[model samples]
Target chain A: MQASNAMAALALAVGASLALAAGSAGAAPPALDEQLDGAAPVISVPWNVDAAGTAAQAETLLAPTAWAEWSNVLGIDLRPGGSGMEFTSNPDYGTFWCSNGSSPAYAYARMHLPHGSTIRFFRMWGQDLSASGDVMAKLRETCLPNVGPAATPTVTDLATLQSSGSSGSFTVTSSPDHVVDNHQCAYVAYVQFPSCDATTSLRKLRVQYER
Target chain B: MTRTPFIAAVFACAFLSSASDAADFPNRDFRVITGVDGKPARSDDSYSYASGNYRCTNASTRATPHVVRYPFNLPEGTSVRYVSVYGRRTSDATPITLRLRQVCQSQSASDPTSTVLATRTPAGNADGYFISAMEFSPSPNTLDCRAWVEASFDISTTACDASKAWIQRVLLETEPSDRIFRGTFSVNVDYTLP
Candidate 1:
């Protein structure tokens, strides 16, 4: 009995020492990712919403060739310079603004955050070429009623941020209500560039969320 | 003291060591982004919310011209294992296609590069629902370390056929690059040294 007790104590002591050595020798501490239940860590998703090769709708009733001339609610025209989208600037017509027409023309980019994700913040990467004109980004959430007949879904702006200078990025922190409740909401990231300077553009959007 | 307590202590130590080792592997991560989170590829491709999902219908008469791209924001060095797109077709003749696309941009290059990892089009059931899946193999799988990944869904039929397709959700299954935790940790859990 004494021999067994001594052996067990020695084995435990050796095991504990080895474990302490590992923990001290750069073994990372237990983290959320290390959890057995598969709880997700904070993940940041980057979206290049302004990439080329996609088409947008035109606000005016025109041919497919002219649809890129006007910024539509679905999307916007890609800038001729690079991988970005901007409002169309026609020499014949002045700068087109979303607030100009009877029907507002705000460009939209679909947001894909993981289900049950709580948005921490999102960054808008782009250039605001004009100092006078500002670029606005609004995170809109529309939740359809579960028990109703197709009524107009209540649209809410969870957060909105903008920049007027030639900044490369703008970060908008989420409020308490920024959770992605997919059971009742659909999220859309909207960007409206009030300038037609050709350089004023929206390049990319990054969403950081926790699941 | 009794030998029972000593044996129990030894067993407890062993269990703690095993847990620490298990932490090295971490848990496989997954993300299920709904189809409503995606945007239409063009204005002519209209979408309506139905049953808590986006039902997209193409307006163009061309074959498979309508597309909806869903962006993925996983960490760098994320080994994507499987991609499954959930959707249904309104017409029996039409099929829904899911494509896994990766884009890599070099610092010296003027244009960003892109590649298609996999493409799958699943057959619809009697209820018109289908789950298009693509799985990668050989251990490491497809790593999205320095690239951008997205799942683009294409409606296989022409708009003139009155066949519409909508995605219910996209499931992305991935494993960490190495046997270590590389990203942020949850603040809710209290982690301590073993």
Candidate 2:
């Protein structure tokens, strides 16, 4: 009975979210050149946590201790009798990394949202291994104005996970502008690994946007 | 008697849906890349953006051969035919290699494997930047749904100096299809019966 009720609730939540996305007022939908009357399109970008751009930094942070755990950076235990990406401090002291600190871990996927589509939401599937640790995920947009020799780009946090649920999505409260403006400004989606502890594995990060 | 009719109905609905989906879309041009969409592969790579143009500055010997990748965000199974990149080099002799590659990553989060589908070397035009394009034969070359697509910029041969290599845009002309799905899908089915 609980399983059935949970499934039904999930379906309802999805339906509500879609309706909300479809109703958001913003730019006109791009012309579907081939399908004159087809439904608006949606683009989904999925990234593995290992795809994070700051992986080089993460490896540095994890350091030789991580090396002793896993043979490779991907956290695979190729070495004989080696544990796979597990970390347990000898003194059991608390450490906050990944999503915090001066360099947060972020995996970037190029955004090609049709010129006028609206960003809907972001979803992540991962596990927080430590009982006191947090595995937070958020979607960030970094945009650079197209009319400069080189200038500081803008970064905006579009959406963030509301809870520790295995699978969760939060609506974007910021502007729904999903245009790929080559002449004005360009945008890229960066899925952030805001907070994570040892043994935390992020299987996937997905961004959904509608045309 | 009821089970047989129910199975027949399911099949009929699926067939109709497939037929209608095919009829709705016709082959059309789809552009997925612009110069501004590219991101530097390495943190140390030097890049500049200006008026829809992306410039890779080979300023440091340590940062020579900058690689900027423009990832494709089109639907899975989309067919691509023509690809063009417009750009100019500060020095007419600067060399750049543009590659169309399909990259596949296994579920184990291991190293992503890639295959070069096409390669185009843009020629330096005396009159600033011109379009360098390649048309694939047996056209409508379908993209792999299980892999990611990207246009890789390789400026390995370019001189390592303050000189700049600029790219205005990268365009892909694709045929519109009914398969509008996005992202990679991994499905496992069990056939063992109880």
Candidate 3:
């Protein structure tokens, strides 16, 4: 009986050890916030002077551009403006529009990241023609995996800023759950008058990330 | 008695280990296209295409093309087994063709070389929105696969032309105030990771 009891205890020990091994193997790496001793700049997307150009121009400037700060992960090509709008640049900010008495317009910027990287937060500054008391604006993120049907896209609402009743500036910061899968690319869309007959514009936008 | 209990413990341990490994595989979603306002002249009085919608063309047009391409990539050791495409059109009976191709390294994502793997023409949903799916079982599975989609629709003046038919993304909008139509295209892929 004593020998049998010893064998049972040994089996229990073996099982427990195996469980621990499996647990460690499957555990996710430490999050970006936990990895740094102090705040360190990992990735930055500046939609300012450098990114300030016509959508047609942006298509060339943004494509195959390397994020020098990160391990040189190549950003994907940016398409020209969407169907309804035109990209315009100004001294203070870059903007796109459907103009007054014009049809609704849409525009977006997209990028590809290195596998397993995550976006911690995103920041943007913009406003709609609602200051003219005419329209409103909305921002959303569409994330897609590397492999799948092109027809289906995952859309997430980032923010919705009503017309300030004047051309005032609005800024927004994203929450942490906005993760990008290691196997997918990310698309950030700035929509003006989504339903049509409204006008909006964006002055500045930035995205911060970690490897 | 001792042998039986020991064997059971070993089996339990094995099962747990396999489960943990399977949990590491990642699943993701992507929007290849969003909704855009249909062509102005194609707008029908009954169905307002002025809002953000996509219009189909008889042949490729300067405004709305008959064929559109979207590019995507897969991680090493991962294979896609199934794809689900969701779209909505102004007309219910329009027919659309979807083709999957292997992208050559030399070609851009927007332009792929001639290596077509699968093609299907799903029947449109008379109800306006349709969800079509395709399953794939490649003979020799490959890792690090780069792929793209070539989607086209028939152009019948009376049936599926600019005036009668349009396509849009399938999105649930909570706010009616938003007017911009981000062209909508969604594809759900079932993948297995090594």
Candidate 4:
């Protein structure tokens, strides 16, 4: 019995030591290359509601293009740029500032890069609305005014482009004509709305990406 | 020096050692989750689907062209070869595609640098619903691939075939996505290699 007890004790001691050694050796597991690499860049297109009965109608019209899950939401954060982003923490329908009849709303999205990937820009094309007339779309960086006042962002800075139209209602679309920066490890995309109201709205945004 | 005592001791020791190792193993369940919500008023455009064709629903709370992230863990051996993805659209029947493989070779543990393995589309269908399959091996060296369905459903499909999107938010499959759901959900699929 003593021999058995002694052997058991020795085994326990060895096992415990092995476990401890392993626990200590492993610092932290590195992050994985899951979806970011292949996943498309995040694109935020603030819906422009300018048509007659547009705000309510656009929702039903673009139901299919709507986000389906929590994961589909754009991930956006304030970057380290000279000018920062501005949004309401508890916005009823996004941060509202510009007027289309009611408060204009915007959407934010976020994505992660491989820490050192360079993003080459491409030409941007968008329509005023999904079921549109003349193409009307633009892109921009952060929505401004710090929830107070904004510079009425345009495609020049944020790449916001106003689609040409014979009618008044239009959808804006745009992307970087220049290079896009991959800050640290995060990449943010913002869709701003200066007058994405009842007369004009934004829809369908795509970013052509390259390695 | 008795043979019986020695044999019994050896057997007993072997059993106890194995039991300890098994206990140390990741025998418990774990989960994987990922997603996004940047622009609110943009309308919900993104969607999610799981194995056995389980779809995620978007309440009228959030909007679209969003970001999504899911976290899932795996045991020593897990395969990541194939997964499926589904999307919806409205009057615009364009597809929002998702790829299944990574672009770069990476370390065995976690690979966040490898690019997505699938292509993006403006449309979604069963033809669009496949994931690549590889040898089932998740170890300490070779990185298992991760996938992403770049965009979400279309406005046309969501309105007309909204039922399809509704019956299941849509489809997004990974061969061993089981790596994530195995421990947590009631998933009992075989991962043993044939």
Question: Which candidate has the top score in TM-score?
Answer: 1
Residue B126's lDDT in candidate 1:
61
Better of 1 and 2 by lDDT: 1
Q: What docking grade does candidate 1 earn?
A: incorrect
Residue by residue across B1-194, what tens digits does model 4's lDDT show? 68999999999999989988745424233222222311222223334444323233443333232322221212322334223333333223333333332222221211123334345453335433333222212322222322223333333333323234322122222332222234222121112200
- Compare candidates 1 and 2 on TM-score and give the better one: 1
Give the Å error, residue A188, model 1.
11
TM-score of the second chain, cand. 1: 0.63
lDDT of 2 by residue, A1-211 (tens): 9999999999999887655443321122322211124233532222223323211111001111100100001111001111121222100111112322232244433333334445543534344444433455445566676654787877776666522423221111122334334344444434334333433434333333433
TM-score of each: 0.44, 0.42, 0.32, 0.29
Q: For candidate 4, what is the recovered fraction of reference interface contacts?
A: 0.02
lDDT, model 3: 0.37
Candidate 4: clashing residue pairs, number: 121
Worst 10 residues of 1 chain A by lDDT: A65-74
Better structure of 2 and 4 per lDDT = 2
Give each prediction's DockQ, rounded to 2 decimals. 0.04, 0.02, 0.02, 0.03
Looking at model 3, give its docking quality level: incorrect
lDDT of 3 by residue, A1-211 (tens): 9999999999999887665543321132212211233333433232221112211111111112111111100001112245333333221112333433334544454433344544544434444435344233334556675665775777776554343433333434343434555455444545444323324454433344444
TM-score of chain A of 4: 0.30
**Tens digits of per-residue lDDT for model 2 on B1-194?**
87999999999999989988745434454454567666554444567788877777655444245566554423223355566677765435456767665443322232334456677776655555567676543322111112122233344544433234677887666453222211111111001100
In order, the Cα lDDT scores of the candidates are: 0.47, 0.40, 0.37, 0.31
Please say which candidate is ahead in DockQ: 1 or 4.
Answer: 1
